[model samples]
Target: SNNDYNYTVDLSDKSLILISINYTVSETLEIPSTYLGRQVKNLSSSIFVTTDTSNVKTLILPDSLTTLDNTNIKPIYTLENLVIGNGITEIPDSFANYMNNLENVKLGNNVTKIGKNAFCGCARLKEIKVSDSVKYIDDYAFIGCSFNKVLIGKNVEYIGDEAFGYFDYILSNKGNSNILNPYYVINGYSSTAAEKYAKENGIKFIDLNNQPADTEQTYTYINDLVAGDINLDNKVDVNDVTLLQNYSACNVEFNDFQYKNSAVTHYITSITINNVTEIQRYLSGYIDTLEIYSVG
Candidate 1:
């Protein structure tokens, strides 16, 4: 059923985005998946926030969703459950910052990044699962949170400052913690970034890999190629740029991996080399892939 809401599309991409919704909304809602015959892929910060509508107890996202803008996520005063669809690649900046009463979050498996302040100040959040594909978690993303259990995937490469740590307010106010398991304990594999982070912050760590491997989503790859390495040369150079240019112009077809990977790789390496134009070109291609939701 289509919940009453308004939207605006990105003219250049035909991507759907929700702009507003009426205040008279149901307590539990399944946000409409389509608008104007196109699948809605991006959600604005206010679309389902508790500040905008306090009646929302659960917000079910669409599988078409790829982006959730959290730059201005007002507190979810009453929202207890949130479902992130599998197409989503990242939870954008401030996605759930200051949602002081949130209790549960169902993150998608495809998500790779958790933006800055994504879940900051969620004091009542008791459990969260960082999907296996996630690689980055930004600064203050979970500041002041008092989660009882947090399972970080093996793929995680970085965790930013003040994330999942004692925030200024948390320290001063002396919040509640799991009594039997007092300090924070990140459920992750030993020697992984999660373990390192836990060690540095005096947080506890639990080894997840000791369990049956088949039962878990293993993202730790023994051999991984760097992005933008089109030629498999282990470096992003002018030849890679030329290859991308040729591929875009339809002068070449991919013999390496897929064009999407090549394009994304090109996009990542361009930033280091200061190739602004090439970076923008490849970045657009990469973003286009993510926006398509179910890319065929």
Candidate 2:
């Protein structure tokens, strides 16, 4: 009576199952749709922990699968390409930890939450496109990645704490210069908040606010601040030197001296005269003053 009787009653009311299979699978794996007459709805923890699927490069999750908890599953150390089905809503933490060669990821449209440290330490990952269904991103989701670009979808509303922390590390770290200008395009309808966040965190924000409007041009302006010319009359000559000497000796006060749009409120440090003959005359007068002081 193993195949007959009330097997249907037991199978229909079951929510979880733990089964062990002894089979050797090669490089690529496709989870079969029908397993023991019931649809493979979810994966149990540590299901592939001891399985020798080290050579597997691509994993195709079943469409009916709604949850995947990596608490017991062995890390996919050799997986470079991963394809998640659209039915998945959450990606487990530490999902991409040991995937050193993983360079590209395509997330499903039904995904709503990305676990913390889900994609951390993926140094070779260059690009990622989050689907429109994503609503929350946990901390350090993309930490320590060398990716220079990230394209967020339109429906993404919240970028969690330290969600872009790795981007700040790439920009501030003096040791690594290869991670330059990583973000080129961010596609979303709520781009204003994204732009503000980018600018506040030192990332260049390309204003994509216009649909039919053309891109705005950027320009740089330079202004120099120089001292010694109190009045800023353009020439550092005898008149300027006399003015400086009088100001320093307290004979004349800077009641109205203003330069470069700011009030000259401090004492002048040094004066540079442009005329050679005037400099010679000023030195002779200084020598005469010293001689007089020595004799007196």
Candidate 3:
């Protein structure tokens, strides 16, 4: 009765069709290319009920597949690799939950929408490449992935709330000190909102409006000096003193000048003059030693 049952029904004029399959074992399954007459457009609900998931690695969806909304089709946990065909446009919510070992995901070129929490909790996922055809990415689509980087394609327009929530978590955690902070380089996004968000959350945002022509542009700060060395010569000395002297004179013509040169020397002279009284007490001792040496 299982083999003879019809798995396909014509729905050319209708909008939807429902089919049922009853299986009692877990094993390698190659879904038939065509069931009855109409092409197998979707995997029926509760089609695979076996607990042993060792043999399942690849799932090839038919071109006619436009939806995979079956609640009982939870075989995604057993699948290490999933290839969605060009016909599918959306992935259901929480479709990839608990799939800790899924490493790579190749989204179809025609897919337009990804549901919320679609790929949450994929801890071992290394990369996600959304195609140019994707227009909307739902909230938390990649919430808790351990991937170090994320590459958003050009066609994406909207990033929902908490889409990068896990990234913030990783940065705040004490264990991830060695991981470099993620830098987000977006071409066309909300400049005001993105700037505000990055500032508040300590995330790095790079504006790519006009990137440097080559690597030489990165060397523009060869002369920038902080507190340690003001002259940019990698050492502090008399030249620094000269700079401070010129600065205190209020000479507006020169750009590099320091006020410490004049102020420090005046302070030292005042200190020496104030200690002249103490120097008088040791002067007689020095004269006595000179007289004894002359007599000898």
Q: Best candidate per TM-score, number?
A: 1
lDDT of each candidate versus the true structure: 0.62, 0.50, 0.47
Candidate 2 segments whose C-alpha is farther than 4 A from its true place: 1-19, 70-74, 165-187, 191-193, 206-296
The C-alpha RMSD in Å for every predicted model, in order, reads 20.7, 17.8, 19.1
Top-lDDT structure, candidate number: 1
Q: What TM-scores do the predictions have?
A: 0.60, 0.58, 0.53
Ranking by lDDT: 1, 2, 3
Candidate 3 runs further than 4 Å off: 1-33, 50-53, 71-73, 165-296
Model 2 residue 261 lDDT score: 11
Candidate 1 lDDT, 1-296, residue by residue in tens? 26456777879788878866754667776766787788888777666443355677777787888767542435446788888788888888878777765777888879999999888767677666776799999887877566545788888999887676444231111122111213455788777778888887767677887853222322211024344555656665667777666666668765322232343432322222323244445545643321101111
Tens digits of lDDT, candidate 2, 98-186:
46777667777799888887887676666667766887777778765655445555566667554552432221112222122223333
Alpha-carbon lDDT of model 1: 0.62
Tens digit per residue, CA lDDT, model 3, 1-296: 56522354546733223344444323333454455554666655655443334566665555567776863345656666666767788878877765866756667778888888888767666567666677777877776666534445456666665554243222111222211223333222234443333454444444334442111111111112222132445444445444434434544322111111111211322222212222232233432210000000
Name the lDDT value of residue 242 in candidate 2. 66
